[model samples]
Target: MLKLFSLSSSLSILFLASAHAESQVQLSHVPSQSQVEDFNEPRGASKGVEARPILVIASELIKYFEGWYPSAYDDPAAYCTIGYGHLIALQACASIDLGEFARPLSKGAGAALLEKDTRTARIAVQRYVKVDLSDEQFSALASFTFNVGKEKFADSTLLELVNDGDFDAAANQFGRWIKAKGKVLPGLKDRRACEAALFRGNLQSGKNSTFDRSDCAGLGVASGAGPVIDIFVGE
Candidate 1:
Protein backbone atom coordinates (compact mmCIF):
# COMPACT_ATOMS: atom_id res chain seq x y z
CA MET A 1 0.00 0.00 0.00
CA LEU A 2 2.88 2.44 0.78
CA LYS A 3 4.59 1.69 -2.56
CA LEU A 4 1.35 2.25 -4.45
CA PHE A 5 0.78 5.59 -2.68
CA SER A 6 4.30 6.77 -3.53
CA LEU A 7 3.75 5.91 -7.23
CA SER A 8 0.47 7.91 -7.31
CA SER A 9 2.11 10.92 -5.62
CA SER A 10 5.00 10.88 -8.12
CA LEU A 11 2.52 10.79 -11.05
CA SER A 12 0.61 13.78 -9.65
CA ILE A 13 3.84 15.78 -9.19
CA LEU A 14 4.93 14.95 -12.72
CA PHE A 15 1.58 16.03 -14.09
CA LEU A 16 1.84 19.39 -12.26
CA ALA A 17 5.34 19.97 -13.64
CA SER A 18 4.18 19.20 -17.17
CA ALA A 19 1.33 21.68 -16.80
CA HIS A 20 3.73 24.33 -15.57
CA ALA A 21 6.05 23.72 -18.57
CA GLU A 22 3.08 24.07 -20.94
CA SER A 23 2.03 27.33 -19.36
CA GLN A 24 5.56 28.73 -19.72
CA VAL A 25 5.54 27.75 -23.38
CA GLN A 26 2.19 29.47 -23.85
CA LEU A 27 3.42 32.57 -22.11
CA SER A 28 6.41 32.65 -24.41
CA HIS A 29 4.01 33.23 -27.31
CA VAL A 30 2.32 36.17 -25.54
CA PRO A 31 2.83 39.75 -26.63
CA SER A 32 6.34 41.17 -26.38
CA GLN A 33 7.20 44.10 -24.11
CA SER A 34 7.12 46.59 -27.00
CA GLN A 35 3.78 45.26 -28.17
CA VAL A 36 2.39 45.54 -24.69
CA GLU A 37 3.60 49.12 -24.43
CA ASP A 38 2.04 49.99 -27.76
CA PHE A 39 -1.23 48.40 -26.76
CA ASN A 40 -1.28 50.25 -23.45
CA GLU A 41 -0.55 53.74 -24.81
CA PRO A 42 -3.33 56.30 -24.44
CA ARG A 43 -5.59 57.06 -27.35
CA GLY A 44 -4.22 59.52 -29.97
CA ALA A 45 -0.66 58.51 -29.19
CA SER A 46 1.01 57.09 -32.31
CA LYS A 47 2.58 53.68 -32.52
CA GLY A 48 5.24 52.53 -35.03
CA VAL A 49 6.02 56.11 -36.01
CA GLU A 50 8.64 58.64 -34.98
CA ALA A 51 6.81 61.04 -32.65
CA ARG A 52 9.18 64.01 -33.07
CA PRO A 53 8.29 64.81 -36.64
CA ILE A 54 4.58 64.47 -35.93
CA LEU A 55 4.99 66.74 -32.92
CA VAL A 56 6.92 69.31 -34.94
CA ILE A 57 4.31 69.47 -37.67
CA ALA A 58 1.46 69.55 -35.18
CA SER A 59 3.14 72.30 -33.13
CA GLU A 60 3.80 74.35 -36.22
CA LEU A 61 0.24 73.99 -37.46
CA ILE A 62 -1.18 74.87 -34.05
CA LYS A 63 1.14 77.85 -33.75
CA TYR A 64 0.08 79.03 -37.15
CA PHE A 65 -3.62 78.68 -36.40
CA GLU A 66 -3.72 79.71 -32.73
CA GLY A 67 -0.89 82.29 -32.82
CA TRP A 68 0.91 83.13 -29.60
CA TYR A 69 -0.99 84.71 -26.75
CA PRO A 70 1.47 85.23 -23.89
CA SER A 71 -1.21 86.80 -21.77
CA ALA A 72 -4.72 85.76 -20.92
CA TYR A 73 -7.18 87.78 -22.93
CA ASP A 74 -10.78 87.50 -23.95
CA ASP A 75 -10.97 85.51 -27.19
CA PRO A 76 -13.36 86.49 -29.94
CA ALA A 77 -16.09 84.39 -28.36
CA ALA A 78 -15.13 85.78 -24.90
CA TYR A 79 -13.28 82.95 -23.18
CA CYS A 80 -10.21 83.68 -21.08
CA THR A 81 -7.36 82.48 -23.25
CA ILE A 82 -3.61 82.28 -22.76
CA GLY A 83 -0.55 80.76 -24.39
CA TYR A 84 -1.36 78.98 -27.67
CA GLY A 85 -5.13 79.15 -27.29
CA HIS A 86 -5.19 77.49 -23.88
CA LEU A 87 -8.14 78.57 -21.76
CA ILE A 88 -7.26 79.71 -18.26
CA ALA A 89 -10.20 77.93 -16.70
CA LEU A 90 -9.48 74.54 -18.23
CA GLN A 91 -9.56 71.70 -15.72
CA ALA A 92 -6.20 70.45 -16.92
CA CYS A 93 -4.58 73.75 -15.94
CA ALA A 94 -6.46 73.98 -12.65
CA SER A 95 -3.55 72.70 -10.60
CA ILE A 96 -1.04 74.99 -12.30
CA ASP A 97 -2.31 78.11 -10.49
CA LEU A 98 -2.19 80.68 -13.24
CA GLY A 99 -2.68 83.93 -11.32
CA GLU A 100 -5.31 86.33 -12.66
CA PHE A 101 -7.22 85.55 -15.82
CA ALA A 102 -6.08 88.83 -17.36
CA ARG A 103 -2.49 88.58 -16.21
CA PRO A 104 0.36 88.25 -18.69
CA LEU A 105 2.02 84.86 -18.84
CA SER A 106 5.77 84.54 -18.91
CA LYS A 107 7.42 82.84 -21.88
CA GLY A 108 8.25 79.79 -19.77
CA ALA A 109 4.70 79.53 -18.50
CA GLY A 110 3.26 79.91 -21.96
CA ALA A 111 5.53 77.24 -23.39
CA ALA A 112 4.69 74.87 -20.57
CA LEU A 113 0.98 75.47 -21.02
CA LEU A 114 1.22 74.96 -24.74
CA GLU A 115 3.06 71.66 -24.19
CA LYS A 116 0.38 70.39 -21.85
CA ASP A 117 -2.41 71.47 -24.17
CA THR A 118 -0.71 69.86 -27.12
CA ARG A 119 -0.41 66.61 -25.20
CA THR A 120 -4.08 66.72 -24.38
CA ALA A 121 -5.01 67.44 -27.98
CA ARG A 122 -2.83 64.66 -29.27
CA ILE A 123 -4.35 62.20 -26.85
CA ALA A 124 -7.81 63.24 -27.95
CA VAL A 125 -6.96 62.68 -31.58
CA GLN A 126 -5.59 59.24 -30.86
CA ARG A 127 -8.52 58.25 -28.70
CA TYR A 128 -11.21 59.30 -31.12
CA VAL A 129 -9.67 57.96 -34.29
CA LYS A 130 -10.47 54.28 -34.69
CA VAL A 131 -8.48 53.64 -37.84
CA ASP A 132 -4.77 53.31 -38.41
CA LEU A 133 -3.24 56.53 -39.71
CA SER A 134 0.05 57.71 -41.09
CA ASP A 135 2.11 60.14 -39.06
CA GLU A 136 1.05 63.07 -41.21
CA GLN A 137 -2.59 62.09 -40.97
CA PHE A 138 -2.35 61.76 -37.21
CA SER A 139 -0.55 65.10 -36.90
CA ALA A 140 -3.08 66.90 -39.05
CA LEU A 141 -5.96 65.45 -37.05
CA ALA A 142 -4.22 66.47 -33.85
CA SER A 143 -3.83 70.00 -35.15
CA PHE A 144 -7.48 70.09 -36.17
CA THR A 145 -8.64 68.84 -32.79
CA PHE A 146 -6.40 71.40 -31.11
CA ASN A 147 -8.19 74.14 -33.02
CA VAL A 148 -11.63 72.57 -32.70
CA GLY A 149 -12.42 71.18 -29.27
CA LYS A 150 -12.31 67.45 -28.62
CA GLU A 151 -16.07 67.17 -28.09
CA LYS A 152 -16.75 68.75 -31.46
CA PHE A 153 -14.20 66.59 -33.17
CA ALA A 154 -15.56 63.47 -31.54
CA ASP A 155 -19.05 64.28 -32.82
CA SER A 156 -17.89 65.47 -36.23
CA THR A 157 -18.61 63.82 -39.55
CA LEU A 158 -14.90 64.06 -40.25
CA LEU A 159 -14.14 61.48 -37.58
CA GLU A 160 -17.00 59.28 -38.75
CA LEU A 161 -15.80 59.35 -42.34
CA VAL A 162 -12.21 58.68 -41.39
CA ASN A 163 -13.23 55.70 -39.31
CA ASP A 164 -15.31 54.44 -42.17
CA GLY A 165 -12.27 54.58 -44.48
CA ASP A 166 -13.71 57.39 -46.57
CA PHE A 167 -10.60 59.54 -46.73
CA ASP A 168 -11.74 61.85 -49.51
CA ALA A 169 -14.97 62.77 -47.81
CA ALA A 170 -13.18 63.26 -44.55
CA ALA A 171 -10.67 65.57 -46.17
CA ASN A 172 -13.44 67.72 -47.57
CA GLN A 173 -15.17 68.02 -44.20
CA PHE A 174 -12.51 70.36 -42.86
CA GLY A 175 -13.75 73.14 -45.08
CA ARG A 176 -17.21 73.02 -43.55
CA TRP A 177 -16.11 74.21 -40.08
CA ILE A 178 -14.96 77.72 -40.97
CA LYS A 179 -17.67 79.77 -39.32
CA ALA A 180 -17.26 81.50 -35.97
CA LYS A 181 -20.21 83.47 -34.57
CA GLY A 182 -22.02 83.44 -37.94
CA LYS A 183 -19.00 84.90 -39.76
CA VAL A 184 -16.47 83.09 -41.92
CA LEU A 185 -13.20 84.02 -40.31
CA PRO A 186 -10.42 84.20 -42.88
CA GLY A 187 -7.96 82.73 -40.40
CA LEU A 188 -10.11 79.64 -39.83
CA LYS A 189 -10.76 79.26 -43.53
CA ASP A 190 -7.08 79.27 -44.27
CA ARG A 191 -6.34 76.96 -41.36
CA ARG A 192 -8.95 74.43 -42.43
CA ALA A 193 -7.74 74.45 -46.01
CA CYS A 194 -4.21 73.86 -44.83
CA GLU A 195 -5.38 71.08 -42.58
CA ALA A 196 -7.35 69.50 -45.41
CA ALA A 197 -4.35 69.71 -47.68
CA LEU A 198 -2.23 68.06 -45.07
CA PHE A 199 -4.84 65.33 -44.64
CA ARG A 200 -4.85 64.69 -48.39
CA GLY A 201 -1.05 64.39 -48.52
CA ASN A 202 -0.87 67.40 -50.83
CA LEU A 203 1.52 69.25 -48.55
CA GLN A 204 4.98 67.70 -48.61
CA SER A 205 7.58 67.98 -45.89
CA GLY A 206 10.96 69.79 -45.84
CA LYS A 207 11.74 73.27 -47.21
CA ASN A 208 9.40 72.95 -50.17
CA SER A 209 6.24 72.40 -48.15
CA THR A 210 4.10 75.50 -47.74
CA PHE A 211 0.52 76.02 -46.47
CA ASP A 212 -1.15 77.89 -49.31
CA ARG A 213 -4.12 79.96 -48.21
CA SER A 214 -5.27 80.37 -51.79
CA ASP A 215 -6.92 76.95 -51.75
CA CYS A 216 -9.69 78.34 -49.57
CA ALA A 217 -10.42 81.33 -51.80
CA GLY A 218 -13.55 80.05 -53.51
CA LEU A 219 -14.97 77.98 -50.67
CA GLY A 220 -18.14 79.79 -49.67
CA VAL A 221 -18.75 80.78 -46.06
CA ALA A 222 -20.58 78.50 -43.63
CA SER A 223 -23.41 80.11 -41.68
CA GLY A 224 -23.62 77.64 -38.80
CA ALA A 225 -20.96 78.74 -36.37
CA GLY A 226 -19.38 76.43 -33.85
CA PRO A 227 -19.20 77.15 -30.14
CA VAL A 228 -17.13 80.21 -29.29
CA ILE A 229 -14.36 78.39 -27.44
CA ASP A 230 -10.62 78.62 -27.71
CA ILE A 231 -8.31 75.62 -28.07
CA PHE A 232 -7.51 73.35 -25.09
CA VAL A 233 -10.45 74.48 -22.97
CA GLY A 234 -11.91 71.59 -21.00
CA GLU A 235 -15.60 70.87 -21.03
Candidate 2:
Protein backbone atom coordinates (compact mmCIF):
# COMPACT_ATOMS: atom_id res chain seq x y z
CA MET A 1 0.00 0.00 0.00
CA LEU A 2 2.91 2.36 0.76
CA LYS A 3 4.48 1.65 -2.64
CA LEU A 4 1.12 2.24 -4.41
CA PHE A 5 0.67 5.56 -2.59
CA SER A 6 4.22 6.72 -3.59
CA LEU A 7 3.55 6.03 -7.29
CA SER A 8 0.20 7.90 -7.21
CA SER A 9 1.84 10.95 -5.56
CA SER A 10 4.56 11.04 -8.26
CA LEU A 11 1.92 10.81 -11.02
CA SER A 12 -0.09 13.71 -9.53
CA ILE A 13 3.03 15.92 -9.41
CA LEU A 14 3.80 15.26 -13.11
CA PHE A 15 0.20 16.07 -14.12
CA LEU A 16 0.29 19.37 -12.24
CA ALA A 17 3.55 20.38 -13.94
CA SER A 18 2.08 19.55 -17.33
CA ALA A 19 -1.01 21.62 -16.61
CA HIS A 20 1.11 24.62 -15.58
CA ALA A 21 3.11 24.38 -18.82
CA GLU A 22 -0.09 24.29 -20.88
CA SER A 23 -1.49 27.34 -19.09
CA GLN A 24 1.69 29.25 -19.77
CA VAL A 25 1.50 28.40 -23.46
CA GLN A 26 -2.11 29.63 -23.67
CA LEU A 27 -1.42 32.97 -21.95
CA SER A 28 -0.59 36.03 -24.13
CA HIS A 29 2.88 37.50 -23.82
CA VAL A 30 3.27 41.06 -22.63
CA PRO A 31 4.52 43.58 -25.17
CA SER A 32 7.84 45.37 -24.72
CA GLN A 33 8.08 49.14 -24.25
CA SER A 34 9.32 49.69 -27.80
CA GLN A 35 6.54 47.51 -29.15
CA VAL A 36 3.90 49.43 -27.21
CA GLU A 37 5.24 52.75 -28.45
CA ASP A 38 5.26 51.56 -32.05
CA PHE A 39 1.69 50.29 -31.75
CA ASN A 40 0.53 53.70 -30.49
CA GLU A 41 1.82 55.70 -33.48
CA PRO A 42 -0.67 57.40 -35.80
CA ARG A 43 -1.90 55.34 -38.74
CA GLY A 44 0.14 57.09 -41.42
CA ALA A 45 3.42 57.21 -39.45
CA SER A 46 6.01 54.46 -39.78
CA LYS A 47 6.06 51.59 -37.27
CA GLY A 48 9.15 50.40 -35.40
CA VAL A 49 10.87 53.54 -36.58
CA GLU A 50 14.17 54.82 -35.30
CA ALA A 51 15.70 58.28 -35.52
CA ARG A 52 17.44 58.69 -38.85
CA PRO A 53 20.88 60.15 -39.37
CA ILE A 54 20.99 63.44 -41.28
CA LEU A 55 21.40 62.49 -44.91
CA VAL A 56 22.80 64.44 -47.89
CA ILE A 57 19.33 64.90 -49.35
CA ALA A 58 18.12 66.61 -46.20
CA SER A 59 21.28 68.78 -46.09
CA GLU A 60 20.68 69.88 -49.65
CA LEU A 61 17.07 70.83 -48.97
CA ILE A 62 18.04 72.97 -45.97
CA LYS A 63 20.94 74.51 -47.83
CA TYR A 64 18.58 75.60 -50.57
CA PHE A 65 16.63 77.69 -48.06
CA GLU A 66 19.45 79.07 -45.90
CA GLY A 67 21.72 80.04 -48.79
CA TRP A 68 25.50 80.14 -48.40
CA TYR A 69 26.92 83.49 -47.43
CA PRO A 70 30.63 82.99 -46.84
CA SER A 71 31.21 86.56 -45.75
CA ALA A 72 29.65 87.69 -42.51
CA TYR A 73 26.54 89.68 -43.31
CA ASP A 74 23.54 90.95 -41.41
CA ASP A 75 20.37 88.88 -41.62
CA PRO A 76 16.98 90.52 -41.94
CA ALA A 77 16.65 90.34 -38.19
CA ALA A 78 20.04 92.08 -37.86
CA TYR A 79 21.81 89.02 -36.58
CA CYS A 80 25.36 88.80 -37.93
CA THR A 81 25.07 85.90 -40.37
CA ILE A 82 27.69 83.70 -41.96
CA GLY A 83 27.92 80.31 -43.65
CA TYR A 84 24.33 79.24 -44.32
CA GLY A 85 22.27 81.36 -41.92
CA HIS A 86 24.50 80.75 -38.93
CA LEU A 87 23.67 83.76 -36.74
CA ILE A 88 26.66 85.10 -34.88
CA ALA A 89 27.54 88.61 -33.83
CA LEU A 90 30.61 90.15 -35.53
CA GLN A 91 32.31 90.24 -32.16
CA ALA A 92 31.45 86.63 -31.50
CA CYS A 93 32.52 85.58 -34.98
CA ALA A 94 35.91 87.18 -34.45
CA SER A 95 36.31 85.18 -31.24
CA ILE A 96 35.36 81.75 -32.66
CA ASP A 97 38.08 79.38 -33.90
CA LEU A 98 35.92 77.72 -36.53
CA GLY A 99 36.52 80.22 -39.35
CA GLU A 100 37.70 83.73 -40.10
CA PHE A 101 35.08 86.44 -39.64
CA ALA A 102 34.19 88.54 -42.68
CA ARG A 103 36.07 86.16 -44.95
CA PRO A 104 34.66 84.45 -48.03
CA LEU A 105 33.76 80.87 -47.07
CA SER A 106 34.39 77.92 -49.29
CA LYS A 107 31.53 75.62 -50.22
CA GLY A 108 33.07 72.96 -48.02
CA ALA A 109 33.45 75.39 -45.11
CA GLY A 110 29.87 76.64 -45.55
CA ALA A 111 28.58 73.06 -45.59
CA ALA A 112 30.49 72.26 -42.43
CA LEU A 113 29.07 75.32 -40.65
CA LEU A 114 25.58 74.31 -41.79
CA GLU A 115 26.04 70.83 -40.39
CA LYS A 116 27.08 72.28 -37.06
CA ASP A 117 24.08 74.64 -36.92
CA THR A 118 21.67 71.91 -37.99
CA ARG A 119 22.85 69.62 -35.22
CA THR A 120 21.21 71.97 -32.70
CA ALA A 121 17.92 71.82 -34.59
CA ARG A 122 18.07 68.06 -34.85
CA ILE A 123 18.66 67.69 -31.12
CA ALA A 124 15.76 70.05 -30.37
CA VAL A 125 13.41 68.12 -32.65
CA GLN A 126 14.36 64.80 -31.05
CA ARG A 127 13.69 66.20 -27.59
CA TYR A 128 10.24 67.61 -28.53
CA VAL A 129 8.84 64.70 -30.54
CA LYS A 130 7.69 61.47 -28.85
CA VAL A 131 6.43 59.54 -31.87
CA ASP A 132 8.50 57.94 -34.58
CA LEU A 133 9.05 59.95 -37.76
CA SER A 134 10.25 59.16 -41.24
CA ASP A 135 13.56 60.59 -42.51
CA GLU A 136 11.82 63.15 -44.70
CA GLN A 137 9.53 64.27 -41.91
CA PHE A 138 12.37 64.59 -39.46
CA SER A 139 14.38 66.53 -41.99
CA ALA A 140 11.53 68.91 -42.68
CA LEU A 141 10.98 69.60 -38.98
CA ALA A 142 14.68 70.05 -38.41
CA SER A 143 14.85 72.55 -41.24
CA PHE A 144 11.87 74.45 -39.84
CA THR A 145 13.44 74.51 -36.41
CA PHE A 146 16.67 75.68 -37.92
CA ASN A 147 14.91 78.65 -39.49
CA VAL A 148 12.48 79.49 -36.66
CA GLY A 149 14.89 78.86 -33.77
CA LYS A 150 14.33 76.20 -31.11
CA GLU A 151 12.61 78.49 -28.58
CA LYS A 152 9.83 79.54 -30.98
CA PHE A 153 9.51 76.03 -32.37
CA ALA A 154 9.16 74.70 -28.84
CA ASP A 155 6.32 77.16 -28.15
CA SER A 156 4.64 76.79 -31.54
CA THR A 157 1.24 75.37 -32.47
CA LEU A 158 3.04 73.60 -35.32
CA LEU A 159 5.13 71.58 -32.89
CA GLU A 160 2.10 70.90 -30.73
CA LEU A 161 0.13 69.57 -33.70
CA VAL A 162 3.07 67.50 -34.89
CA ASN A 163 3.58 65.92 -31.47
CA ASP A 164 -0.12 65.01 -31.39
CA GLY A 165 0.24 63.31 -34.80
CA ASP A 166 -1.88 65.83 -36.64
CA PHE A 167 0.64 66.26 -39.48
CA ASP A 168 -1.82 67.80 -41.96
CA ALA A 169 -2.86 70.43 -39.45
CA ALA A 170 0.75 71.04 -38.54
CA ALA A 171 1.59 71.47 -42.22
CA ASN A 172 -1.13 74.09 -42.55
CA GLN A 173 0.25 75.93 -39.52
CA PHE A 174 3.49 76.68 -41.37
CA GLY A 175 1.79 79.25 -43.59
CA ARG A 176 0.70 81.36 -40.64
CA TRP A 177 4.31 82.27 -39.77
CA ILE A 178 4.93 84.39 -42.85
CA LYS A 179 4.90 87.69 -41.04
CA ALA A 180 7.98 89.40 -39.62
CA LYS A 181 7.83 92.55 -37.43
CA GLY A 182 4.05 93.05 -38.06
CA LYS A 183 4.36 92.84 -41.85
CA VAL A 184 3.82 89.92 -44.22
CA LEU A 185 6.95 89.32 -46.22
CA PRO A 186 6.67 87.78 -49.69
CA GLY A 187 9.94 85.89 -49.34
CA LEU A 188 8.80 84.39 -46.03
CA LYS A 189 5.50 83.43 -47.64
CA ASP A 190 7.36 81.50 -50.35
CA ARG A 191 9.69 79.81 -47.86
CA ARG A 192 6.81 78.80 -45.60
CA ALA A 193 4.95 77.30 -48.54
CA CYS A 194 7.98 75.24 -49.47
CA GLU A 195 8.42 74.18 -45.87
CA ALA A 196 4.70 73.24 -45.70
CA ALA A 197 4.99 71.21 -48.85
CA LEU A 198 8.01 69.43 -47.43
CA PHE A 199 6.20 68.68 -44.15
CA ARG A 200 3.16 67.31 -46.02
CA GLY A 201 5.34 65.07 -48.20
CA ASN A 202 4.17 67.09 -51.20
CA LEU A 203 7.50 68.60 -52.22
CA GLN A 204 9.17 67.25 -55.37
CA SER A 205 12.75 68.18 -56.08
CA GLY A 206 12.46 70.98 -53.49
CA LYS A 207 9.46 72.58 -55.22
CA ASN A 208 5.91 72.91 -53.87
CA SER A 209 3.35 71.36 -56.20
CA THR A 210 0.34 73.48 -55.24
CA PHE A 211 2.18 76.59 -54.04
CA ASP A 212 0.18 79.78 -54.58
CA ARG A 213 2.49 82.10 -56.44
CA SER A 214 -0.07 84.87 -56.04
CA ASP A 215 1.33 85.81 -52.61
CA CYS A 216 4.74 86.70 -54.05
CA ALA A 217 3.76 86.95 -57.67
CA GLY A 218 5.95 89.35 -59.74
CA LEU A 219 8.11 89.94 -56.64
CA GLY A 220 10.72 87.53 -58.08
CA VAL A 221 10.44 85.55 -54.87
CA ALA A 222 11.33 82.21 -56.40
CA SER A 223 10.70 78.97 -54.56
CA GLY A 224 13.25 78.39 -51.78
CA ALA A 225 14.21 82.06 -51.74
CA GLY A 226 17.12 82.28 -49.33
CA PRO A 227 16.46 83.42 -45.73
CA VAL A 228 14.71 86.78 -46.52
CA ILE A 229 17.52 88.44 -44.56
CA ASP A 230 17.40 91.56 -46.65
CA ILE A 231 13.74 92.27 -45.85
CA PHE A 232 14.29 92.73 -42.14
CA VAL A 233 17.53 94.71 -42.53
CA GLY A 234 16.17 96.92 -45.37
CA GLU A 235 19.26 96.12 -47.44
Residue-by-residue lDDT tens digits, candidate 1, 138-234: 8778777766666677878789889999887787777776655444556666777778777777655444443344543345323342333322231
In the predicted model 1, the residue pairs found to clash are 43-127, 44-126, 44-127
- Provide the global lDDT of candidate 1 against the true structure: 0.60
Per-residue accuracy of model 2 over 1-235 as CA lDDT, tens digit each:
9999999999999999999876543221111112122234465353343434564545765665566677876544334667766656433443555456556778898887777656656777888888887766887788766666666677777788888998877766766655445456555666667666656665554243222334322232234422232221221
Worst 10 residues of 1 by lDDT: 27-36
Q: Residue 42 CA error for candidate 1 (Å)?
A: 17
